[model samples]
Target: MRLPIITFGMALAFCAVHLFVGRLRWLDRTPRSRWLSFAGGVAVGYVFLHILPELGAHASTFEDATGLDAPLAEGLVYTLSLVGLALFYGLERALALSRGERMAREGRDRPHHPVFWLHIAASALLVALIAYLLNHREDPSAAGLALYFAAMVLHFVTADFGTRADHPEIYDARGRWVLAAATLGGWALGLLVELPELAIGCLFAFVGGGIVLLVLKEELPEDRKSFFLPFLGGALLYAALVLGETYLAAA
Candidate 1:
């Protein structure tokens, strides 16, 4: 299904990006730092592409059932609809964060390199390609996927900016919780109104919940939150859920 294709492509892309980052020689400089940076890229990719989408879909279904009029695109609505309503205004606050934005704002606070921006542009292109592939068929379920993409984009932006500004060296468990809540809470709200797919929603929610717990592993003193952990966990969860769904469909 779409999940497998998305997962494989993401994994491939993750590896490629890491390889590129490894060549930086300045940012990574050390072997351990290089590995960590690569790991972070992989984790970010998996979360944005996989786990977030599933959560968004579930939320969309829930909203449709409960008749909350959360703005379903195709009997599939998104928790993002709620966020988009806020995002429009939230940007007005002007956090003076976001490295990309900061670069533009400072007019001269530019980093002594182009590798980061190059990587970003490359990532945007990759995401565009992935979106093109995934954006076919405006069915209810597909609509859910679309919403997931939007929500994940926002989550990624927030997490990227937050972690980068507040704790460049350490991971932010607080931000992770917020991300989880935003994603899960959105789905839960959607589900409240959309019960037709309750069973399916429950299945998705179970997987989503697993993702949250797995992410919490980062909070553990011993676990130390590798970038790979979130990605690997999300990929495994998605792969397992997709397989299970396929088996059931076949049966």
Candidate 2:
């Protein structure tokens, strides 16, 4: 039980990277694009290799338990994913539209967009959900905890860069703190209660879908500028590592 408390420290440290890493001169000089691509690769790889399989099994079980036909359950899962994608991308579109309106009305640029804050709020919820899942997992071994921390911390850093880049000041000032609080909030919830298997499966689908849309939309900018080698390298490498670990654990 006491070991779980370290998760709070881990959450703080994870959030701290968002808060302070921008201030480092060396990081400033580094080519951020490739790093972000690799980190995104790592995250996307983890989802496909690890989380998706679990989500699939859970989804199947959920359908069985609920007495829903396979097709219906599958369709609903797909729709949930599409809904998640639409929400985030739709928010981006709304932001663009709002920007156009502001420019026409004011005859100049607006420094900030409201949609960015919405994204921040949405992302905070995601962070919390993820933290809750991590803390409430069936096994809480040292090795498992470490690996989960390593993977998720990178995922958070990469996913967060997109948000911070969009509105550095806003994300840095208030968004970071909000996310930190959300992490602790999730942890507290995990300590207090557990979600039913059905709810877990649904949350997994929602978040997985959101992550797929979020990472791709953020990584793929206009002009198609990206590092494919690093991207593939990160994905393949992480996939191999995760698979190897899973096999060893099973054996």
Top candidate (TM-score): 2
What is the TM-score of each predicted model, taking all chains together?
0.27, 0.85
Lowest lDDT 10-residue stretch of candidate 2: 23-32
Q: How far in Å is the alpha carbon of 120 misplaced in model 2? A: 1.4
lDDT agreement with native, every candidate: 0.38, 0.70
**How do the residues 38-127 of candidate 1 rate in per-residue lDDT, one tens digit apiece?**
433433444555556755666666776676554553233233333432332233222223445656877543232233333233223323
TM-score of 2: 0.85
lDDT computed for candidate 1 = 0.38
Model 1 off-target regions past 4 Å?
Answer: 1-113, 137-233
Q: Clashes in each model (backbone N, CA, C under 3 Å)?
A: 11, 0
lDDT of 1 at 178: 33
